[model samples]
Target: MSQSKPSFSDKKQITYYSRLTQLGIGEEILITLPELSGLMFTSTRHCRTLLGQMHEYGLIKWEPKVGRNQRSTLTLLYTLAELKAELAQNMITAGDYEKALSLIDNDKALFEKLLVHTSGTQMREGQLHIQLTYDRPFSSLLPHQPQRNSERFLLRQIYSCLTRCNRDGAVSDALAHHWIYDETNLVWKFFLRPGLSFHDGSEINAEVIVSLFKELQTRPPYIKELAHIQSISASGALCIQFELRRPDPGLAGLFADVRYSIQPISQLLSTTKAIGCGVFQIQEHSDEKLKLITNNQYHGYRAFTDSVTIWQVSRSKDYNPGEIEIRTGGLVSNQSSSCSSYLSAGKTNSGLSEQVHNRIEDGCLLGILNHRSHFTDSQLKKIRYLLFSNESLKNKLDQSLDYNIEGVLAYNLLPNWVKLSAITDNDTQLPKKISVALFNHKGLEGCAKAISSILADNGIECDINCYSFDEFYRRAFASTLSEDLLLTSVNFDDNRPTSVYCWLLSDPVLHQSLPQQQRRWLYQELEALSSITTPQNYLTQLEPIATTLVASHLLLPMFHHKQTLHFEGLLQGVKMSPWGWPELRDVWFEQ
Candidate 1:
């Protein structure tokens, strides 16, 4: 086997030749010079040189300017049988040779009329094409920097977390081959896989792991997560140990988050561009598109597609067939026929042959009252009653938004898994007028308008105000909200119920504007709840506190927003995280 192996320098050339041979004899392949150049990762001049060499060898004939937009044609001179024999002699393993032959045999018809093009290149037998939406144009490859859903999706391809969380909420190893927790010592030790190399060809080991965590600690969210960590030390090349201030059962889940992806310390300091050990490597990235090629040296399950291209689309209607379109803004009432709609939670439209929708229970939307508003206590009580009890407004919002009101309705802060008794409502008379403020997120505009309309129908005169997210945050921090009520949403990325409540109650900007006695009691209640370790005890202790908070009308739980992913065609082995992002490693195109 070793004696028949091709030389390292010739391997890529052989692979390229093999791909061309799969086209079979007499096949007129229509491919633009730019497309071929991108596929080969070379300049147009270099691609021309490679094509000329192939033409000289009698493997293919290049016909210049034969198709639309001056695209050239390349005719293959070798048959599949001849290519199989050539690959058999060059491939290091019998399995590789057989796989190559099988692909050619399976896609024989496609090869006969293959139209090589950009955008849909991944739809071809060995490619994967995807479309994602970003809020704005950016080039930061760092996993933590990109705040949009599209950028985060692209980052997942380039980065690998220490651990992975499955759809069933199970924690599994990714970079860390195995891990163990020392309860008595409050220590967590992880054993990494051997011989793992980053995309930049740097070895992954314990020292690198420790350094990444140390660097991560300097960031905002990671700093909060790692606050309990006393120290992170490397025992050897393959083992890393973390000492914590206290026992945390959910520590492994924290590592499973993509934000904590491990990267080389050198890359962290040297550049903002990413260098990862995941299944894909960034070939090129720009404001409009992000292109990735498979990382052959990846230690885990390799992606089936040779390359993936993510296009930044302005609207859902821009999606095309054979592409995975991620629509962060909920599906509009008017969906175009260009592509089938798939919810982010993995639900498909009825009768749509090619669609994938994965529903993720990500977070809840809440109605927050500005406690510092000038309204008297009685007036506040009436406002809360009108907002929560008005079913007409909720229904209109639900119909316009196309969301299940009952399914997403949140009566408590805890997730559905933790069942707490519902709060008893004390009805109050409607006030003459009320004002509500909403952040100017495009998706929330319809819902906010619906609320205003509903309030108008009642005796109350409704004043609806919109503010930019930054302006809203600034006013919120300064406790100078102009509206009586604020409409906003919060994602509980951390599955732990305690963490969710801690964030809600402990936010200084949010709760500081409350009356002194109410603020004191809220903090006191949170402090007591924080001490309970067991989930059962915690839930039992939290029931009355949640009830009290709801009754106080400071925060009104509205509904949980279900995250969905819509795709144009069938995708196999697709799964989603609790936070609504797709697990793309195992996903493959199904034709």
Candidate 2:
């Protein structure tokens, strides 16, 4: 074979082209203004002169030399493709790299443009600016659907849920007091608080509650813990009874979950009424924006602002409040870092200032495994191994992480939440701890903090690694992923109290993915654990782990951060709940 002549190593080679399709740059040729129209600006002849001047300055290069004698007027042709590349190279090589980088990285124009166009959905002439970063098309914008609630944004403004958190950052006692278990957790009785009502002017009563439970039994979505119920009887005006086959101790905490609480049955019937008993009432709503008015009849603390608006934003640019009018989303607890600074100086470089006026709603994040996958067996085993072998994981899991080692929870929610027979493990069988992974950076920080605090209080010791939400999702959903879990927030409408709990404690009455027997077993385990009291005793059991892990400073607790809105000017005179709402009755806006 003729040895490939040494590839020309030193010669500089160049390729010239009329257009750079990849970069969207094209060479410029001057012809009377006619050609310029198609090549540069079709509406204006001004572009021709602009290109001419650019070539003169050597900012762009001309193709053929200018001639002296020409019929029409001869001018030099320039290559925008070559000019841009040269400019890009100069930016990389120059010491002032930031200037060049800025050309690519700057988003100021984009954001300002979006700000002008967020309201664009209805306008044809003017740009409506709505800013967003990511899109989850599969998500259900409505609460009763199978998808997660819409991702946080200003749109959270118009809606209000039944449960509101307290100043101590705990779900309000009123919400927690709903479920109370008698001697045997199996005979569970819940009392609907009096004076509670939905926005439809309907008082929440036993009948509405019975209808809600029936709905859960018929159309369970996220409700998992209520599966163990053999039957639920609404005892007239006040009490509801849950009869189970066997005694369970963990039932109380399961009821305490805000996601399992009741909503107004009538309001859920129509999207129009905005009939929630919570702090705010819907004034106006569209896919793009929502306006909420404070409920003067709200039974809880008065809202702090006169009105709250949720405006849909565009995804084209990063946000700076100056580019758009500031709006609030779900409020974060004082567990956030900026809360202290805000309380002291009234300002800080954090999202807290914006979210301060928002409110807290009940939610739970859970992990759902893809049991049908080929690697399901290995993943399940791996999760079991990790949860049992890793002391730290198990310790954090007791309170925030709820699972049944027996595997009673359904693989998915399909048809509804209904009672399934209890599963029994052999006497020799040991409970398996579940191995789970969560985002170290996002809401997981709060989960980790809660677990760590419990560990510290109980004198257990452990170490934890920090991770981003993206990484967590990747690992949790990976194919080779054996033994991985994801944290999902369970947000329930008040009208759907027992739905989530039923799902947690029953086999798939709907999806029927996992064997009914296996699901029943899982439900039974969950029900037993759900009956167990966790708030006080949970930390004590972790003492052994705390002594070893925390003593070494391995596991650390970090507080959760949430966003809200605040007003400074004469706007201070506006009266509403922590999250803004136009509380029209007893409250009014001064400005």
Candidate 3:
């Protein structure tokens, strides 16, 4: 009989090959059915099924041990790199680029080629489909539940808020075409466009708006933000009225918030998908990719790009984003043998260029020190010194930031925020060692390892804890912070006072976990600060509070950083949103 070939598509075959490849290729001296089964993630019976297949491929030599506790000798015929490359090639040929990239073992040439094939904007079946890679699988795109900036960006495309804040920080009409506030009577009325509908094609009228807010009456920030409203009701088919106990000038900004994005109540309760009324609708979402198509029925200008496909891929994605040159004035056709077609209305992209553009972002790799239970004041000071005093460590931290956040060293983003003050007494009896907390995200484990190594070198004991976004949000709200330091990146992406206010209000560990008296005082201070209108006035009033935060060493802002993103010249009418993502709504992909 002819020897059978192993199928890469078969999970069992792939697992068997992968495990055999790890058993010291032709050098393995001992093994057993149970031990082998555990390594392959299959039962002993399943392991037996793979024995014949493994032998048939001449990839593994297996000798069975009949008795329990008896050792079996198994030896592989191939190295891991050899097996992975073959499997990765197989996946690549099959057009499973996400899976292919995951299996690649630092094959730079292969990585680039796979990325080139998987990425870039292409015209397909009357739609301009732009493809890009993300580091992980799709998570919640629900209006209020986004855990990261990427998710937030996707949410903006998939959902519509009552109002929207523009690049100039001015509030503009969105779902609500026109709104008026009766400041004297403490009442507000919003008029929705007639014939508006949700993504599901259901009528999205004043009644739907009123019903959604009623459901949100119990959720966070909303409960506090909308508390002044005595009643919210529908005036007619197209009008919503809010009767308030107090005047709320910030209602426009509040409605612009992601928390208030309108979605069907039924889909809001589903875990598998998010539905809304925006310029784009989720056509397909899976572990490999999230596909969004233009909603032509959108009340606003229809999205120029018909589709955007975000491929869930590994960071091994390496390709020159400058591949497509964006030139204006005259049209340029492809000189190569390959035929060129329009990806969008007038955009014509030529191949890769040697030139690249740089974008300096205003963000930071912030280290928020939990000033409560974990560490004493003295210990916190020492920790700060060990973290910030060394220029070498800052370089390493900057590198870590680049890997994790795609950021560069921020020398002076915030003059008052990034404190470099040294500890007065290095020899004074140091306080107890503390734990460091990290978010469970890509490239963050490396940050934890780097931090732990630096502290360990200085004779300091450091424990590391990782939490998912859910755990981080849920625990912090209950005023339970177990770690000494909560290190995360902050973009202040929204770039509005509301953004700052939202940060202060939502970060329970930063505010709510404070001493009862201190928390109350801060709340009152924020309440007063919220009413200030002018920038100078806001800063003048906020300075004292900021000073207290830094001087008291509540949370140490260690490193402020900037991220560099590449945009092709062909991408036209694209501007970075306040949230640090490129606004794709009206982009032409002009080449």
Candidate 4:
């Protein structure tokens, strides 16, 4: 895989050779040396070597022209696809799957045939590793750094918090066995479980727990989320205590958030990977894939599954809306101990309840109009109305963004009790041209195209920019400030309203969207809700933030996504978590 070869011996030899065949095969055609080199994706010297290799294989005949910009005559002898297909088939039959699969050369037909049996799941060294086909690469595994729900799920497995939230939104034991609130002193003491160790075999004592919370202060989101903690001190070797400036009704639930996962950062492969005390340990981490091994040193019940490997899979040329479906068709047997699947929402083909788990997530795909742009309030209102005021536009967008698969038209930002149905005031100004930015993702380019097509009919020009995942999220400020609109998805634990408080304080993009006075006023409003003990009272008071944002036309909710997981029938205890992800530790294969 590391060594280079003659361009003719390249796996894409099929594509290059077939292109040459198009130039009146068996008859010399006039073509420049540079043109041939460009077609073959090789240097001029390699072009000559490739021609020689092809001539030896009876694929093409070449004649050289000895002057600059002079034409070179090349005659094709045979078709390349058929020839390479035959060789690759022979390689497949001879057990050289690696070499056979290398002939992708962007050929969809050959790729499907060769990949049919190699994708999905397999057993190696008696470990059960389910290879889930994912659309994006794995993000950092460190606590408070999750960029997606998938990464959040993986991080949840790889780390533990002092407390955990049950499915019902109640606090439960995690690293800490139990906790008691001292009413007199406004303190919380959490009793830790004994015999706990990190993935690296370091003891997880009270001091380690104290260090974890101290570490959280340096990370954003949590830095604001944990602001109520006035002090974190080790009570003893097996206990930890927290002193708060004021009483927090939801402190335990806040601590249970996965963003607050306790982990000791460690170095590996010249990059840092988290060393956590959870049911699973990250054994391999990369952009291509992430593999987790069961943590044998965990305090409580160990993970029943041996391993979970998520493969970062991009959509091939032949892709369907119903499925990203990276697994090849036919001969990829279900007989393996592990499973591999390109998951999508809805009932599976088997019609069995156990075959799939599905639920609507609390997240939303949002189109935020950039307030930093030159657009007036009336213009932003006009754009929002044009995009979402009518039913057909939202429906058309639903299909473009795969929202029809298992999503609902978002009536409001929060999925809970808030229902917004007010008609937008149509009296407005309009922009002649706007620049739109989107995080380059599945169906998003299509989304931009659809929006462009709609705006073109309205005599408005659009400049579209798509940023990679890293570029969009890691740039430290709202990249959309320079554009007219930004399209992205946000997942938050809306089961509790603390997320609303945290997002307002921590989300740079959202924070930058409001005017200076408006932002200051919103911050003061959010600050006033901190002491509210009742969840209903808290949410009721917080309702104005959503109404204010919508009234100002800062952001529009497009759709709410539905998350689903498909697993083999043998996998037991398959269920969806509140945040729309499955806990891998809870799943086990049948013996």
Best TM-score goes to which candidate?
4
Candidate 2 global TM-score: 0.41
- Pick by lDDT: 1 or 3, better one: 3
Question: What is candidate 4's CA lDDT for residue 159?
Answer: 80
Estimate TM-scores for all models.
Answer: 0.60, 0.41, 0.71, 0.71
Span of 10 residues, lowest total lDDT, candidate 1: 112-121
Query: Ranking under lDDT, best-scoring first?
Result: 4, 3, 1, 2
Q: What lDDT is reached at residue 179 by model 1?
A: 91
lDDT of 3 by residue, 1-591 (tens): 111265434555766677666566678668778887888888889888787676666657777778996888887776766666656654543446667767775665666545433354555455666665555676867875635656776788898988886423467888899989787897889999888898878989988888888777766645666666889899998999999875566667667766678887665567767778999999988886788989988999998888776665543422111112122112332311111111222222445332223344334455667756546567656665666445645566446533333344332224333333555456655544668776775344555666777877777688988888678767777767667777665544452445555565455556644556666777777666654342223334554665566555555554443323344555567655544445667666533
lDDT of 1 by residue, 4-118 (tens): 2332224455466655564456878887987777776778777787887667655678976744457788897766455443444232122132343354454432321111111
* CA-lDDT, candidates in order: 0.58, 0.37, 0.61, 0.63
- Candidate 2 lDDT trough over 10 residues, lowest sum: 337-346
For residues 1-591, could you state the per-residue lDDT of candidate 4 as single tens digits? 101222234556566676676566567788998998887778888787877777666666778788999998787765566666655644443334457657644554564454332343343455554444454567677655536555666767888888776534557788888888876787888898888888888788988778767777666656655677899999889988889877766676667766677766432222377777788898988886677888888777877667666655554443422232323222222221011223221112244233666666665777777667867766777777777545655556555633233466665666663655544456565678878787765445555666776788788899998887667766425334467777776666623555555666567667656667777787666656665453334556666777677667786776666665565554566666645545556665543
Model 3, residue 487: C-alpha shift (Å): 1.7
lDDT of 4: 0.63
lDDT of 1 at 41: 70
